[model samples]
Target: MPELRITTLIDAPLRTVAAALLDARLLARAVRGLGVRISGGPVLFAGATLDGSVGPVDGTLFVTRADTTGVSAELVGGPLPRFTLVTDLLHTGGGTMVVDSVEWSSPGGPFGRLADVLVGRGLALKVLEARAAAVSARSVELLSARVVVGAAIIRDGLLLAQQRSYPPEAAGKWELPGGRVEPGETDHAAVIRECSEELGVTVEPDDQIGPDIPLRADLVLRVFAAHLTEGEPEAVEHRAVRWLTAADLDTVDWLPADRVLLPALHPLLT
Candidate 1:
């Protein structure tokens, strides 16, 4: 069997580069303009699959093993007769470098051998390039943007809180009554809409608390202080809802990001 190898260096920290390589969605985005299709397993490990097509030919590749030291993959099915493709990822002092190699034996006889000589190197390089692009795109996406909104409904000296009951992302955690902002709506409008939908209470547009606070990942979070006008807040989207005093903020498990708002909220509400 003959082998084809290709290597490239990426200018990012090892951990950052590793994470992008491990994420399937990030990998897909990096190779966006390419006509190739790609998919992978839940985690970077043996038995995980990466299936895709280049031009007219389709193929499925599998990760045989991966660890802190390195990672490897094998090509299962493709236009070629028989082949195993392996990729190794390593951390260098300056950045991470990825090297991909392919080993294969001819299917029939001299004709297969000649075809391997013509196509193997080209195929291996195409796969390596696609993988590299995917990793880079994922890194950029994760670092790009994030946005969150929190609601503070204060009556007397108490703040309103809700316990979410949905997916792990939203369930079992106590948070202020707001969500992501939608397109074409003002922050104030989004807050009012969220309060009405989540708590079943109508808030005047003027009741918004203050300007949005910027967070990591280009995220902007807006916290609003509004009054409950018509009815008591019910748990429509959450498992529970309660009015809490400034002292009660410490008792519940608030989201880590929202916890940053507590100290400032304490003095203003109390």
Candidate 2:
């Protein structure tokens, strides 16, 4: 069997780098020079069948794995069952290191490597190098993606809003009560968690209430209609909490992102 190993260091966190590599849309954009494109499921587990030109050859790239730490794939349904590729992401003091290994068998004894070099030059080696560089360059752009959750609780025909206590930029602005979604938490789960921490109450999200408002270049805010399930709503993390009727909505100065929802949130309130 003939084999090839290549490694590169990327200046991004492991999760961020892994996300860029596993993302089908990003890969499609990055792998252009290799002529590889995701042809099947960017599935639940991020599985995909890839096909494209590898020099003069065309065939399917079979993925054996696509997980958090690493991924593996093999080129098949072609002349030589040309290659099997393994990739890993390791965390280190500096940043993430991407290690890629590929294996292939040759017909000739000692000449197999020479044969691979001569015959499979384009797609097997050159394209792979270009693909790796592409992935590295793409890392910075995706590092900023963030998701935020907010709760809009209504009770007795009034909508609950809270005054920000800290974070100078938002110190006095009124806004929906919620916070960042932690890893492995669903939106509703985040809503419930945020309510507990900020309001000292439990809330059940009934439905999503407004558009996904962009909080900044990379942060998004999603508001959910919730009902308090337990404990009294208190300003545990804020300056104050107020419930306002629909007609009084415009009276308070709201955080820009939360204020955008008022029109959509109007009909939902009593």
Candidate 3:
């Protein structure tokens, strides 16, 4: 087996590169011509197995390990010998360094070895570079430039907290069920939109609580005090919803930003 290593520089933030790499579907789209598909029937957790084809070569792309910062995959079977690809992302002074390494057997036996001696390494690496670069350099402007909102609904001396269902980092953590504030939309409007979209209810905002909290460089978190206008709160996008008294506040695993408002929330619950 022969291995080829290539490192490409990208002028984007590390977070942006990391976010792009973690999205398997986006990767499939970015390198669609390479015939890589995440449609591996069913995937387990943490990573995906991609089915792909290049030239006379076809194989299942196995994800051995994957995370925000790095990922490793192996291309196996088909007309080609088995090989693995390892990719890493790191922050550099200018921007980010994406290191891509591919190690694989070419064509197979005698005839295959002959082919490799001719142009196999070049051909194989050409395809690998195309695929890897697709993942390394897609624009991440949209991912970083986003803002979000949260709602704190207090009723009957209890505060409502919903468990997040996605973004494994915040999964199962208690938070207010609100989403991104739309363009030209007020925080109150966003609270209503999110409550209706996420919790299946209508709410009227009473006042703003705490202060604007930064979720990221470009994302902001805002909390609002509101009362249900109609319909009881239903867990739409959340894993579960619970109303807890002041005594239960300290015990609940509130999401980090939401936890900061616990003191302010205690007064409203009373």
Candidate 4:
């Protein structure tokens, strides 16, 4: 089977750009009017589903793997059998570079090549563009939230922490200030609101920490930098609040889900 490749440059930060591509909900939203349905697992690399029409032809594509590095999808049990498409994402300076390749082996030799030339390239490119647009819009949406935001409040090279409110499930473990997403609210807004309601202090959502990192179970956390704007840090919803430098991060008890954000947050703070 021969491979066909296509590459394009996207004008956005790598991590931010990558988050957009990894989100299945964002993909579905971006391809809304295109007669397509897209869905995916919680984590980026888990898997995804794509179903819809390309021009007059209908097909379904299954993403076997997707992450910050790349996305791989196969056209299984579709109009075109044994066709596979893979998209790789790379960080380039302040933007993201996307490369997509398609490969297939059909019994109808020469005729297959001709079909690929006539239809495959165009269809593949359209899907890539749709994916990119979805990611871009989602990034902007996360950046525009006013309340309930993901936060990593660092002081003197250490991140701040709060003990979980709920017991057994998330009890006793320390975590970044944030909470469940509310209806009609952006992830960033949800984080900000969680901080305010839990800490009894106003926090300003500042910079983004990293890509939308997914937990082992099902939570997708969009981390951001937040600054304390009002009130002393008080234990309202949580058991306690403390500041931990990079060196102290390992010492404090952390929630299992929030562990994913540490890798990305550590380097920035320390």
**For candidate 1, lDDT tens digit of each residue in 107-131?**
6777676657555646556656777
lDDT digits (tens) for residues 1-270 of candidate 2: 666667889988775566556544444555564545545433212234676444444567776666556667777876555667677889999998998766776555656665587545655565557657776876666566677889889898889999998899789999999989888888899999999999999988977664454444355567889998899999998999998999878778877556656666778776
Residues forming the 10-long window of minimal summed lDDT in candidate 2: 38-47
List candidate 1 stretches off by more than 4 Å.
Answer: 26-36, 40-45, 53-59, 77-82, 114-118, 140-270
By TM-score, the better pick of 2 and 4 is: 2
Two-way lDDT contest, 3 vs 4, winner? 3
After the best TM-score superposition of candidate 2, give how far the Cα of residue 96 lies from its true spot, in angstroms. 0.6
Q: Per-residue alpha-carbon lDDT of model 3 for 117-156, expressed as tens digits? A: 5334465566557756675544344344565778888888
Which regions of candidate 4 are displaced past 4 Å? 2-4, 29-45, 48-60, 109-118, 145-210, 213-220, 223-270
Better of 1 and 2 by lDDT: 2
Error of 3 at 220 (Å): 14
Which lDDT value does model 4 have at 53? Answer: 46
Location of the lowest summed lDDT over 10 successive residues in candidate 1 = 208-217
Error of 1 at 30 (Å): 5.4
TM-scores, in order shown? 0.44, 0.51, 0.51, 0.49
Model 4 agreement with the true structure over 1-270: per-residue lDDT tens digits: 656676767776665556555655665666565545545444343334566444343566677755557667776665555677676888887578877676765547775666576445565556656766665666555443333246787666767798876877778889888776877887667766787787787777777765565342234566788877787777888888888877776666676435545556768675
lDDT of each: 0.63, 0.70, 0.68, 0.64
Prediction 1 global C-alpha lDDT: 0.63
In model 4, which range of ten residues has the least summed lDDT? Answer: 39-48
